[model samples]
Target chain A: MTTTPLSPTQRTTIGRGRNRMVEDRAELHRLLDDALIAHLGVVVGGHPVVLPVAFAVDLDGPDEDGTLYVHGSVAAGWLRGAADTTVCVTVTELDGLVAARSAFHHSMNYRSAVVIGTARIVEDPVERRHALGLTVDHMIPGRDATLREPTRKELAATAVLAVPLHEASMKARAEGPVDDAEDIEAGVWGGVIPVGRVFGAVVPDADATGPVPADVVRRARAR
Target chain B: MTTTPLSPTQRTTIGRGRNRMVEDRAELHRLLDDALIAHLGVVVGGHPVVLPVAFAVDLDGPDEDGTLYVHGSVAAGWLRGAADTTVCVTVTELDGLVAARSAFHHSMNYRSAVVIGTARIVEDPVERRHALGLTVDHMIPGRDATLREPTRKELAATAVLAVPLHEASMKARAEGPVDDAEDIEAGVWGGVIPVGRVFGAVVPDADATGPVPADVVRRARAR
Candidate 1:
């Protein structure tokens, strides 16, 4: 667990639902680990553009707080535009659907983390290679070790950006619906439908030989 | 099926992966329907801010093509900042994790749709009510029919923004990993681990009475 509290700048601070704001740094790390994809927002042509990208977090890396790595093809316009610019990276896990007695009270149970910071392109070869390994292993642990090293040409074709996790905020809602007393007394059925990601069977390619690796199988069976 | 093709503006055109660009208007509708949440990107204080929002798409609504409605508390700063401004709304479904022979080729199979346009606040009471119903039913089909109508105060406390689906783009990756011939011959495990959202059993609220509704049960059992 990190000792530092989430440093929410003027914009990162929660203004509306203050009750849902989370201050524990450990919780922020857990949410980042659990999320599979992050919605990265960057300004393009003076307009905000959001795109889904795979991400990895380096909890103990050299940064004010930590480092968040997001990669894309070097040819991606968004990646090129985001370098050295203030970007917002948001990761959300929808836990459940909150059904309330009144349509006005319907809501969703979710955990979302937002990191606002300047995204800098990783130039150091060693750090870029490490970030690439983390990105690959984030999806399936221990699988990166079995893969061949990235060729110099392949490394040149990928762009990895690192954003410091300092200016960040997390908000979560995990409870049942809060309906009005009158609506509750009306006897309308209300509950929560839990939602989660499930991994299906691992399908090997036609050219793949031998049994699926143990790490891959374990990841498939997890959760 | 809709007769219109997606109008890709200067920014909406997919520049990096042209092969993954999906042009069929019907595919766009299907992707929007399958996705549960949308990442709403709005410029706040001259920085791009993205938030996860529950969204509903109306295929025959009044607009250039159709209307995409997203709602939040009236007190939300982002919602207020987004009014009458150009906002980018993105919805993505992570279908599978593509594990390749080389770490450089690791990727994900996903379907994503991006809609960029000016967001207008829905002020018409009738249209607001209809959009509210669509938002509720978007979570669970036919759920709006069983809930109590939103009171005037509740309606006043909510802010609903509509963006025309005219400037939009859809991209998807569905196949196995594209590894190099050398990597394939090396015989490293390569395949796709399918990822999907699953709904668990419904947990009724402590005050909720009677059996779970049929629609709720059906939704829980879906996928």
Candidate 2:
């Protein structure tokens, strides 16, 4: 794994003209870390298929550039077909709703990262187990520590894929909506409405043995 | 324009090992309506390309099934190439985080709609105008009534593509984490933390602006 920042390949470049590209590699990691789900796109059965999946990044590795770990049941047809193939994982965080004076100029202030790489299924038992641990920790800081480690049978039932984060790029539009010069005087209200994702109150399970874990409560309140 | 409820083709069925499929048409509509952006996927340059775009649905249409309107600059190379080609538009709403006792069952409570159809670039003057109107109205309800409608030149500079909502399906997994019986007694807390997307205070654009428009305030508050 290359610890260096991701260098944009031709495929990762935004070639279509609206150049709202983010050049920093750290920004890409920030967007990915803050995300809960990623839209995973793969060419399946001769067409493009995009599905949302839970994902985590491997920061524990010594490499500066980390791998994205996405897991599912071994029996998932999509996961089975996705391995050893190019997959595009996209994470988008919409910051604000840009309300431009002109309808044409209206846009959203969003930060989006697109990571394209071949997903390789982890075959090594030790690596798979570690990846599973990282998956839970990524979603919640102190989660994996408290849960029971996966048994050998449990591990066998799951499939985890490691996607290298080499070919990646981030694009964002993060300012107030740009209105036309003439429309500024058109007496219309134009501004940006901050769009925030926050975690609400915790809903305990029906048969929980105790109160919500301290870490869960802390993370939810922080959000 | 098919007014009948959308009839799913073979492609829309969930054939994977674990099926959290939703067969309700109304549920699909609800997910699409409440979303801010849809990841529109089309094979571009011989690879799967997914782009986030602002979209609107035409429920007011005579067809029982609706259409998804996604607009972009006419100069956009991808849009020009995407016309009359099969496209997959997916809208996802992450409702909560399901923290199962075991890491394997940890999942997200989400509602997603996937629409597969050939996107048609609107050409007819009337329909093109209507599609553009739907695009703005979808983002901010009752917005176009206040802002100046697109001029002839502005309309010519923009391209709007309408993808039929006929071949569509919804899938969701909204429940508490499912942990094993043994893990339940292991005493690690298991529950759900509801995730909510809310709009924060509005930031008015520079220069002359009256009070924030009632409609904008209303939309922001409703979110």
Best by lDDT: 1
Could you give the DockQ of candidate 1? 0.89
List residue ranges in candidate 1 displaced over 4 A.
A1-3, B1-3
lDDT of 1 by residue, B1-223 (tens): 1345774688888888999999998899888888888999999988999999998988888887788999888888888889999999999999999999999999999999999999999999888889999998999888999877899999988789999998899899999999999988888889999999999889999999999988889889986
Worst 10 residues of 2 chain A by lDDT: A1-10
The parts of candidate 2 lying over 4 Å away from their true place are A1-7, A17-19, A60-64, B1-7, B17-19, B60-64
The numbered model that scores best in DockQ is: 1
TM, every model: 0.98, 0.95
Q: List model 2 lDDT by residue over B10-87, tens digit each.
A: 787777623678777878878887898988787776677777888888866523386788888888777888898888
Residue A213 displacement (Å), model 2? 0.9
